[model samples]
Target: MTVAPGPADHAELQRQLPGLGQAPGPVDAAVPAAHALLVHPRARQAIVLGGLNIGYELVRVRRRSIGMVVTAEGLSVRAPRWVGLGDIEAALQAKARWLLGKLGEQGERQRRLAAGRIDWVDGACLPYLGETLVLRLDPQQRGLALREAAAGDTPPGRRLLLGLPPQADAVQVRDAVQSWLMKEARRVFLERLAHYAPTLGVQVRRLALSSAQTRWGSASADGSIRLNWRLIHFSLATLDYVVVHELAHLRHMDHSPRFWDVVRDVLPDFDQARAALRDPVLPAFD
Candidate 1:
């Protein structure tokens, strides 16, 4: 004889319960636990728990769209507005393993960088234009100057001399250096923008400094360009590359082959400069 399916068999219970021979009676006892199987239409390989469906989207373009955002408040899943909540949560849970792994890696990298000491005072070694620039404090010099030592230049040696009070604190020193660098950045950036504009057959209508957190530079379709002020920490060559990259955007906004072609036309080996731009140093502040 064949054994009949019980309440433990959820699928079988669901199938058989609806077809019981007796006429429908008033609800007697509550439905058994196994009878509850939630089916979400938008769910793809996602598990359903407590009536909530969770999943992940394979492709997303907007940066604001949340992939896996967890906070003390609760787990929140944001996707394109068109995506259903069930699908969003399901997608998140499906990629939970990968997302946790990436978060751990990022945390570790940040810890390493944080542990690395960054001296912001004079005599500290800092990266500038693909080379290291040693900071020198000279009370005699009246103002900031990028000094290139001559064949027999004296005691201070070859270095960028920053003139400040001997008793100035770190903030004062940092501020003074930044003020000078930004002044130079404005002048130099415009000069470079003008220098490369003609060759690329594009005109730069306006230039501005950007203090954006996530982007190095940006360009408007209307011939306006914005470069990160932090770029002052980089070498002149690297700075020029960024200028060219933004200027090129005047013609091609996307990083498509055509856009890169425009950039390459002006700075042939831009890849090196681009690579150098990724240095993980914070901007100095006074």
Candidate 2:
């Protein structure tokens, strides 16, 4: 998602995953309730949909319509304070298929991420600039350094030398590598900003590295941009698509046709890059 760094009125794009089907239809009482169970940690209400029992956390807010979000934890429903409990359940029932599909997809995504979690040990591997890099502990080194692949190396691939002893714990190694990645992200982002700003005819006021979980980048009306540091793991084309996407926001804050026109002007093949960005199973740092 791309957000505008300002008040609530500012526009932001919500990131949507593919294969999450369309909005569900109206509640069907005739549909037999299944016995499946999905419970949220702070759930206070339960609903039966498509024969499955789903426990979700309900939050009363100042919003007009009931909104549902499915995360790694499960479902959370937020509705207007004046909306009745029955109405809330009706909203959920109306969207039962979509909710259930999203919940299952979230669970599968979490499982894949856990399975791909990188172990911060010597010879542990992680993606860097769309390529795999193996970790190499070098206590005598000053800090993190990237070295070309050397023969006889265990992985025989690119190596990132960490200035830590062989006894260094996982926490130490993870922190050290993360620090290097952030610094490198800043450097690369700055260079790309310079490369694309002139083409888009915009001046970037500032750039910040963001650790946002859902957002890839955001651009404020003031020309400030924040890009997720994890993007450095992908190819440069994918990274540039995000950069141009935000820079174009400086010209047009909303994602109107004109805004995309500006982005398309700078990156003709941006659609491919955008699709490619979603295909990679990024290494789980945590």
Candidate 3:
């Protein structure tokens, strides 16, 4: 099974995966019970063809057969302009079993992603280098700082003192924290790059921070590396996987066997570090 990003809105989702959209099955009553209606804003027709209570977005396009795409926004169907509403409903009935299963998976994924979004206000907490850090609004603080929080004799977590107002809105708090995170990303990225470059027998010409939406990091044919600033949200081990990954590309451009060999040579536990990236649900920026 594969997971995809949640839809931006009711109508912003597009088909990405190839075979995930094509499901062949006879209608079954095993569809899970849905709690609420999931409707696309632009839907022309609605139906409860399957046991699932969600309504699919029926769209008429220039096509010969009906096509179904399950997105984070629910179900969307594309059919020939000539296809009648009855025929479209019948098509959904035929693929009900497969459709319901995929929708359930996507719905759960979206819920987790939604929960992971940061509120970005005073007292909001977030993960830094695999540890919990409470966000404290400190407008008088001269710079971004971290202080240990001790409750009695036991320390439960750390506090990140940001230079922001106590009544700062979400946007203001988000900007201040993000700016500090990017700076730390740059400083940490260079340190790891320098640590592994000589051992990997590679010379890194330059290192830069990237804010790419989908990519973690990239290695160009040139000896430059670009790592996402968001990586600072994860652990040092998780961040090193991407850093060492891009550095390994300096030796092998493609993901051939030689590439894994190079990555394993330095970061012996690289696979474990790579898995950490997915185990944690990152804070949503927007």
For lDDT, candidate 1 versus 2, the one ahead is 2
Residues 57-124 of candidate 2: C-alpha lDDT, one tens digit per residue:
99977654567898777899986565567656766766676787777777677766776798888888
lDDT of 1 at 176: 73
> Could you report the Cα RMSD, in angstroms, for every candidate shown?
14.7, 10.9, 8.7
Q: Please provide, for model 3 over 143-178, each residue's C-alpha lDDT reduced to its tens digit, 9 standing for 90 to 100.
A: 779899967623357988988788888997888788
Q: What is the alpha-carbon RMSD of candidate 1 to the true structure?
A: 14.7
Predicted candidate 1 versus true structure: per-residue lDDT over 202-221, tens digit per residue: 99888898878778889999
Q: What total of clashing residue pairs does each candidate reach?
A: 12, 2, 0
- Least accurate stretch of 10 residues (summed lDDT) in model 1? 31-40
Candidate 3: lDDT of 110? 73
- Look at candidate 3 and give me any clashing residue pairs: none
lDDT of each: 0.61, 0.79, 0.76
Give candidate 1 regions above 4 Å deviation. Answer: 1-108, 115-117, 149-158, 283-286
lDDT of 1: 0.61
**Candidate 3 TM-score versus the reference:** 0.81
